[model samples]
Target: MRNSIFLFVLSLISFGTFFQAQKIGDGETVDVNGLQVSLNITNKESVQVGGKPFDRYKVSASVKNSSDKSYTIRLTSYPQIVLDTGIVELDCVNATGAKLTSKKIQLKMKTQMINVSYSAYDKSGKSVSNVLPVIGSYYFDSGDIISDNAIFIVPSGEKPEVNVRALR
Candidate 1:
């Protein structure tokens, strides 16, 4: 009876540890375009795009900003990619021809769907560019710290559109 009880207690402790590691919830708020936007993050077993498996440690972030003020936000997944040729590569791209080779890249929130807003002016005291909504998929070989950021332009005023399905 004592052995059985010990096993049961160990099982409970293991389960509790697993549950505690899985965290999902709303993240911090930031000024995107000209509006205050909130971000939501959720954990998933895997993330699929176009029916292709992207990553096992998958999470989704929902952004809320504006349609004005040009800015770029970026989301990074913690994983490293090594090509079969033994070359390490990181790919980041956007519709506007913006691309980056590092593990980190900046995304634009220019649409009204994502929740980015404009906020301030530039050094020239002119209204900043519109904010663009960006969706990013990261490919890595190992687990790392996953983080997302909402960037805003000075003298902000624009709000961008974000697509919900893209995050799925």
Candidate 2:
């Protein structure tokens, strides 16, 4: 009887540990390139730019993957940046302060690098017009995570400004 009770208690402890390991949010998995990708965003805060009494916000994006297979993902901006000169650019920035001026961009895991360059051009060979700055970076490994904070700064004056701070 004592042996049976001991066995039961051990089994319960093992089961609890197993459940804790597999437990995740909503049990949801993201499919990426035939593999499951897991991502999460936290520490989100929004504020008006320059206290101009305008509606502006800031969000921190955190992405993660726990699958055994490795995958590559690119963090990209939703709306393209429109410059005052009527040029639409990708709005990507690198550690060296280089900007990516492309339309469609991709970041791969094999290379573990992000390359953003010019992609489209008008009849005059000039870039299209965009106002937002490039706001994305690269991720190389699974279970590997990256984060960035974005801020939209709208001055109280006649112009609206957007500021981005990258938190890797």
Candidate 3:
């Protein structure tokens, strides 16, 4: 009887752990502390950033508040590109060709923020687009959803896996 009880408890613990650590697939939504996040590669193209042509990817990222509470968060981390060679991360430049400066969000009432890909410029205002926005923090209220796109430069013909921070 003692051995059976011990085995039962062990199995229960294992079962609970298995549920908590489920693997998330590409484009699947993941819940992090009551926030739901989804990231997927939408398209790919070849673009020139600094007189050199490069292959860039358009990634769509969205965040939704799954909780009833309002909270503020900071996006201090950016997504990574997981490749067979190594992991890669790129900076998100704004239209003015400057790096994004905001990383804080005040989500209220389950709100969300989405980042989309657009034309990125340099200091000279030249068209250097296809860069992903740096993941920063934001606030969310219950039921709020934000979606946006970002551009990331990677190798041609290589569909690299996007590694968003929430998946970790």
Candidate 1 or 2, higher TM-score?
2
* TM-score ranking, high to low: 3, 2, 1
Best-fitting candidate, measured by lDDT?
Answer: 3
- Residues 62-128, model 2: lDDT tens digits: 3344456443344445443322211011112211121221211122232233344555678999877
Per-residue alpha-carbon lDDT of candidate 3 for residues 75-118, written as tens digits (9 for 90 to 100): 44455332221111122222122133222112222223456577
**Greater-TM-score candidate between 1 and 3:** 3
lDDT of 1 at 39: 38
- Against the hidden reference, what TM-scores do the models get? 0.19, 0.25, 0.40
lDDT (Cα) of model 3: 0.51
Judge candidate 1 at residue 116 and give its lDDT: 49
RMSD of 2: 19.7
Kindly give the stretch of ten consecutive residues in candidate 2 with the minimal lDDT sum. Answer: 86-95
lDDT of 1: 0.32
